[model samples]
Target: MDGGERYQEFDPPKALRPWVRKVWTYACPSPSRTIQRIAPDGCPELILDLGDPYEEADADGVFHLQPPALFAGQMTRPIAIRPVGPVELVALRFHPDGARDWLGRSLRTATDQRLNMTDRLRDLSPPAGDPEAQARQMIDWMAGQRRDDWSIDPLVRTEVEAIHADQPSPPRDASARRALQRRFLDRVGIAPRTLRSVIRFRRVFDHAMAEEAEGWLSAGLDAGYFDQPQLAREFRRFLGCTATEWAREQVELARAIASQSYKPGGPEPG
Candidate 1:
């Protein structure tokens, strides 16, 4: 079922801009609602459920209620979430290596899992009216904890940037490439090659969804995929379903965040 949802996002403070993409909040009054498919898009998020805790289902069919506050790592595959009641949630979507700065830990543990972070945010107040103000409050809290010694590695940043660029070829030197992979795995919680594929796949999906494509072939070529079959293969590999099947799910939150431009914010909650 489609939930009439309200989403709002804020530009992070200058000090945290390099690591933070945007902080956003989503609210929907429909209770017992399920979002069946969340396609992987390479972004990592710290989420806080201000209204109701949701249940998450993994690939194996195992279901568990997610924490009210948690850090969700890079999901290379589809995951499902169902809220037990009407929802009000806030989240911070981090840059590729941004979690390292905020979590003070390796992202490897967080990948494909909702690692509980509720304890860390217990003292902070939830955003009451203004989503932007709350986002800044969260940013300030994270910035206050920044360590002088911590920063995203220069090499890692360069490699991630290359993955997002038009051409994503890795280093020519085998040894150099291996070293880059190690650093990427350590900091980003996934192998360099895997990250590259996810990034590439997401570009196509985003393009396809944003523009009203006539069919997958047009989207595939536009996204730089080798062929329509290649795009289909990647879609099944990452999302465990055909692109057409996924389209039927109508994942509102995912689509809202993925839009090229944010829809205007809704009226503040009472």
Candidate 2:
């Protein structure tokens, strides 16, 4: 990774805060071709590539060039990405419920998929100026796209809040649980349990990175994992590698981007 690479996140406008989490930018003035593994963070994003496009690996491990603009849905697993050249892009990270409202459809159709947005987000042009300006422009566009009727489901909001707070979900009978699962599938593209697992893994990862815990064992335990073995299992499940191996990878750019999700008041990692 280039040492000069830059990444920053900006708060969205008040009107759009319910749906848009934040506007972020990444730029590398000097290019150094390096692949980065991105872990799933349970949020969807709209990316506007202002410079060279990236190459993303599919499940088969074939790297395909991405479009200049695209919508990335809820990711269930890690993905590998490499910049083809100098990287410059602005992205909108959306809340799970927000994405459902913005897309006007069930998120299940978008889960684990990346769709070209050039056609769907018609007439949207890459914003000019610096990162802050670009972020502001993106926020403006998102504000314009809002629908008066768009609102988050109360149950989904409550459940998401409980997860983030590390509190148990309100007790529900089997039938109610099934109903909530269906709603989660539509609005978040994953079940409540799955979201909890991902969020827990993310917390462990973040704590490890910040050295907030003494070691992986402590990190996992603090994040509520039952034991070291369970922690290792989650590491492999979310990152396709042991925590030690992932640390050895030393993909600085990817690490920096991931760290942004943990910023104060930032929505659950995306």
Candidate 3:
């Protein structure tokens, strides 16, 4: 399966650009479909995961679970098989500057999900006991995510502005960028751009698909592809398929996720 889930877009505060990475929530078919990703460092991740699946792999196969984060030195290009069951996950991709010390361990690795300063994620969660409540709770949770606290005070807010626009993928302020980036790399511990690129790239398709276009060429170009071949190259690079094959799956997955039973406010009816 490829591109089967309903992925939501999110932007991080610009001021936190050096420290904060990308953040988002995704809903997909359960028992997630497999995705083969080609990372920047020549590392190929054959990922088959559920919500917030983290890194672990071998020849026998792969295993995924939430927390117990890992160190991803740089951002990687992603390609995924379609998901098979319903899934909801909140994700934060680390920027190079946002690098943290304990990213290589599980959520319980350093101090547990709470004090894990590797990514130094903050949570101002309100109480929620059930599914529906959780959804509503996350809506608000995401709201606070907008405030990137410069310091990790638990309920802290950073002064960074969110940069969700596709244009500045390459930053203009090299010096200042490097300074804030130093804060992430030297202190916190992992790559925030790694988090930004993957999450941003994923959302690119999520938004592209909603337009109900005919092919991947058009979609990629709209996102500023140099040419159809360029788009195809990236498609194959990330997804292990040509543009046509990937487009075919995108269409199928969209339909699968949008069957008549799909409802936004209610449970994904089976």
Q: Among these predicted structures, which one has the highest TM-score?
A: 2
| TM-score for candidate 2, residues paired by index | 0.91
Off by more than 4 A, model 1: 1-4, 207-216, 260-270
170, model 3: CA deviation in Å? 10
- Tens digits of per-residue lDDT for model 3, 1-270: 354545443444454344334443445544434443322321111111224343323334454332422233332343233333455544444332232322432211221012222243334332322333433443444345444333331101121113233333344378866765554334333234543333333433433334344454565566566776765565555445553444444443333332321111110111
Better of 1 and 3 by lDDT: 1
- What are the runs in model 2 whose C-alpha is more than 4 Å off? 1-3, 127-129, 208-214, 262-270
Write down the lDDT of every candidate, Cα atoms only: 0.71, 0.78, 0.36
- Model 2 is weakest, by summed lDDT over 10 consecutive residues, at 261-270
Clashes per prediction? 0, 0, 44
Q: What's the TM-score of every candidate structure?
A: 0.87, 0.91, 0.41
Candidate 1: the clashing residue pairs are none
- Expressed as tens digits, the lDDT of each residue in 32-142 for candidate 2 is 567777788877899988888899988788999998899888878887888888778899998766799888789889888888997866666665448888887788888
User: Which of 1 and 3 is the better model by TM-score?
Assistant: 1
- Tell me the deviation in Å of residue 91 in model 2: 0.6
Report clash pairs, candidate 2. none
Q: Model 3, which residues run further than 4 Å from truth?
A: 1-75, 79-130, 136-163, 167-174, 184-214, 247-270
TM-score of 3: 0.41
Residues 59-140 of candidate 1: C-alpha lDDT, one tens digit per residue: 6787789889999898777777777777777788777777786777788878888888889889877775566767777778
* Consecutive 10-residue window with the lowest summed lDDT within model 3: 261-270
